[model samples]
Target: MLILLLAAPATAQPAPVIYLDQGWSKEDREWYYQVSQGSTALSYDLFLNLEVATGQDLFRSDANSDRYGLITQAANPRNNPDGLPIGLAKTVVTEGRSKGTYVGITCAACHNTQLNFKGKRIRVDGGVGNTFDMMAYVQALDDALQATLADSAKFGRLAGRLKASSPEAKTDLRKRFEREAARVHEYRTRTLASAITWGPARIDAIAMIVNRLTATLTGIPENTSTPLAPTKPPFLWNAPQATWTQWRGVQQDPIQRNLTETMGVFLDVDLQSKSPSEGLFDSNAAISNLQQIENLLTRLAPPQWPEEVFGKIDRKKAEAGKALFISICADCHNAWPYTWTEPNKHGKRFLLVGLVPQSYVGTDKGQFDALRPYAITGQLSDQLPPPLKGEKVIPTDQLYEALQEAVLAKALSKLKLTDAQAADLHGYREFPLPPKPMAVYKAAPRDGVWATPPFLHNGSVPNLYELLLPASERTKKFYVGREFDPVKVGLDTRSGTFLLDTTLRGNSNAGHSFEDGPLGNGVIGPRLSDEQRWAIIEYLKSIPEQAGRVTPFGGPPASPAR
Candidate 1:
């Protein structure tokens, strides 16, 4: 049988709640850091003039203050001693390498965060970060790089560093400089005008990935990325065990997902092939490097609610909330310890994530539409580089089918690898094809959900409190990535927000209303009362602590009629 964590019988909602705290081992802390701080090296660092304005200097510019989020004084300062910003993971690696040293942001750049409640600050690993503007950071780098090329002094500084390297290295650097210059120009001239503001802590991930892999690198004409569909980058906690990945359960393969994400970050992969026997192209994105990241994540623990920072939880309310959770929320937001055995010969466990269809969950359709079959299929080009001459296209609305067969076939052919070999890679790289794009989103496990504020796949609803409100009443425009409002349970977006108007394309906060289903009177689910919503939220805060305590949430099934 497939490794699926099916919920208990429910007419509409569904119920298997997995307790995650059981498997956590303290020894895995090192592994967690390794996974979280993925590659302190950059893919394009071999070419870019990063050495010229390295460290905080790269982030410091007149265009914006806050050092482009280069440093933060987070509560749990791991590996950092100077009271620098949390998740400012960047370092120069010059020790023992064929290629010269390189530097860039790591996984921690987006995944780690600091939660401040009252006067207390607590660092949360594997939590959604809100410090840096990923889009703006890229733009800033491009602008600074462009400036360096034009200025004699700055160019001299860059040249001085390259002068010590081999002539071939110098030549490669020159080529890369020209290539980067062109790419920056293309971005500014072609895409910048159309680029929407992602502010901070949010990104149109796939759109940017398309831009990096297809339009920018391939130098293709038709590959225009849309930044309009911005969504918050999700926290990476207990993902290896997740049966389904992505905001929607579209991605089943973990390795492929990581590789795609790494590629999106521009992992210096050269496509120009010199010989067929040598392989398609060279990339600094090594298989082992990515493997290390994947391996470490499997052992990573989700960030628990910081009792130290947030103070003691009201056990009575939490207990009441736990019962309430079983009654109202257990249908869709169920969890359980899912360990795959047959296919996964090694006994590996994961907290299975539940996927709910749009027709039922009825949250914002923008995120779903952004990642629809059409979105990715549209970016697929039917051309290959020299030596591996073949048409590479999805050619169908069958998104997951194309991902499993067509996409892999094209990738395997390009890499000169066989199907059986690819299969042996791991469960991480291997993916199951969904029959069709169900137009659904994962009813994401509530692990560490307390720490990651500004809820929803698109980061639309500012807080959990707001998320529980009627769809119509949810704040339409709020500033995201501001100070934390511990009482409100999200960012302090009441004022000085970027005016995230939901009326704009891909920014709707409609659907997933409380008290709207068969049981309740609303459309999406039940229109939850304030007390009921508070109860559920309280239980979420207690998830990490309520280990192995099975709450028999076997309530009467709501009428299945949607």
Candidate 2:
């Protein structure tokens, strides 16, 4: 049974409560009040603007409809008088059966917005509320397409023959099937649009194709069942609070990597690294794009908390939390600048703490695997030069440049791979943490503990209290559609949980309990006293809040010192 966290029931509006203590200086209280107010206002405005910009007709007003229509037309390649597709419009519009109507889908369709802050569950409207369920949408769409195509005697025969063939042949057949589906849908939509006078958006066409495909593939009647449920928009509030292990952090790391690697804003690209030319849109040009995003983010309204609710926070707990943070976490999980920095023994390699392990297989192989050709190839497998003589080391700068050039070359060719030699590349690269000693802006807090629920890179763990539990108690097993008993690995007494559940664990996560580390035998931290651990937690909650705009916080603003 798929165990999903149920959304909390809505409650009647209650006055906000504030909790104060002797620990809070009067000045600190005032600062909190102002910040809270500012955050609330900004959050509200930001959401409103986002809805407007995305053409979400949430209010169903005429003005909104008109605005949405105009924006949709501008962004739609089918509607464009010019032959060239502009921005993301062309790629999304031309590739699918739907001309561009599907491209106009709102961000909320995928994000699904409810999130937990502290212990309280907060719901935001207009985003894909649940991340896991997002994958189901893709599956649903694919199933629908297959069903529609199977009805044709010709297509059905082809599919049967393809499936019975070798794996390589089957792969090629599937691609052909999809291409055929796209063509059919395109013709259908064009006919419908001509009949109606107003052109149908690509999304509508795609949906029709999906419905037909689902019927063909699964032998399920499209009209016999309820339509797929809509997903809520995801919350962006306090995203910094996600645990070190959550997929959100992993997702963000890549964005940070792109920022550093390309040196500016970048579009989201597929893992296959397809469309290389398009993906490498110049970073310098991305400055304007980044600024627009930043402006929107900065203007976001702060979450509203009633004065009474704000009053309920135990100032003493928060105050002690602050001091505790400075003493313990400051060393590696820096607070002021909101970044991490640690020096190696020689101090030559300043390690950025809080980096979640990248998900690559070969990286885990001892020194031997590290030397393998596949381990270091990255995206340049096809064009990579043969191993250099004497020294196997590939200069980091050269590797970076090569990857960029290869992507550009592939983009020009519309080829997925340059050569079969490219298959060997596999290993995770370390993401450099954002520089430190920077001012605390509105980003997620890194104080180590107070942030609760949805820990890890994917928001898998529910809360800090759960994080504190010993490994055994934490190792629960459950599949996507089936329910299972929550595993008890005895983490309350131990430091880490054992990897008993194969499905829940991600790739490269084979090991003993997280508690039993140090000897390279466990998955978690060094076991600690309950008091010490909580102290660490308390310290994490005390990070100072920053109210200013986000700019680069630390490290040298100019070129690095030689």
Candidate 3:
């Protein structure tokens, strides 16, 4: 029998020895900016219709007329202008029968965002993109494509752009477009029915992955949809050394983790029908892209606090805040000691990874439960249309486990990842990592927490100022997608146009309080006055400035002190 461990909510992890200044070289910052601004890991191009039967670009000419896509553009580190949105890179279908170069979205879409404070733009490379609305983008794409297809003039304009040869060709193109449009529409319709509505910056990422594997790819008979367990996509500055990733620590291998994410983006690994001219699949190319991106991100360092924009830090206040942080939040937010072994070419990097107990973090429970080994979250919704529902529920984790044990080719066939034209999309990894069920989240090295606001795993709270407030004083719902508020040290809650309702399933902001408690006390941390909380925030903002300092935990320097 395959071993799938369904772990209970574990306790908080021990703190790792962290330095006040994380030792990142200048080269690391340059590499990180490239990784941030470039690289898509071979996009699924969900924003574009990349899967049409004919190799035709039937998209509206004004596809990018709206300069900003889903979210606003921030400072461009490299200033490469191809008339594309930030974080979206341009790539071509090099080996496919359907030959065309297209722009694709990348990791930066969700990980990189801007904070506009008083007309000054502050670009936070690995920060929470709290303004992005992913679900809405998908739905809007569906609506726009459908609308474009229905209008005769619009269809004519698109046909002219495609340069269709004859009436018959145009007819064939329209039919092909209709088919592709329906595919997207069906996907949108099915996913929308789970009663899952995500506010800006939050998504049911795990659910999107599972749903693709079970319902969209496999065509599960039961049609049980995955639950909408939305959480904030994690920052990448400290990700290279993370013991595990995803809020629940579901992903361990960086290569596999990134591969699974590309699949979520709709990387076309397989063709529905074999294109005799173009061969079946591009496994090597796809894997190479993932590898390239993984390597690029390895050098990533967190965005430094912009003292120029935010103004010089109050050294006195910051120093006091650093002490307060060490005393109050270090238990869970502390960083670990990381080192590369000597003769590092063949030696692996090592970190004393500290894992946070999931059950103890008081923010939200919805995202934590996603990896419940025995829990069945992808059952067909009773609310789904009669034809799609009423079938026996197929346990999501069980089904995935069964598939994992099967032959790779055979499993791909079962999962609809392989087609007559293509044998497999590259089954290097399964959707959910073979279930070594972890029940805790990470204490997540507080390396770059300052820029990553809307704090907590689910992004339930907006900023440090609000986060430090008692739960009762926290706003239940507030607008997102506004400019940064420099004074508040968070997104401008006042001008937020998107209402993020915490009452939603995965958006509970009721945990991570810092009052009336101490280290090791289950949910809450040490008590702190408002001034102290601001001090801690000050320390966080100044993390990059404190480079080459004595290590926290009061010990001799490790590894020759950088």
lDDT of each: 0.53, 0.28, 0.53
Least accurate stretch of 10 residues (summed lDDT) in model 1? 552-561
What TM-score against the true fold does each predicted structure earn?
0.73, 0.40, 0.73
Question: Which candidate, 1 or 2, has the higher TM-score?
Answer: 1
Per-residue lDDT of model 1, residues 303-357, tens digit only: 5554544556777877887787667666666543322222232233334456677
Worst ten-residue run, lDDT, model 2? Answer: 34-43
Q: List the residue pairs that clash in candidate 3.
A: 44-266, 223-380, 224-378, 224-379, 224-380, 274-421, 358-440, 362-511
Q: Give the TM-score of candidate 1.
A: 0.73
TM-score for predicted model 3 compared with the true structure: 0.73
Candidate 2: C-alpha lDDT: 0.28
lDDT of 2 by residue, 132-224 (tens): 232222222233444534544433344453353666765675575566445334323321122111110101222122222222211233211
Residue 440 of model 3 has an lDDT of: 72
Cα lDDT tens digits, model 3, 286-332, are: 44455555554554556556665567778888899888777766655
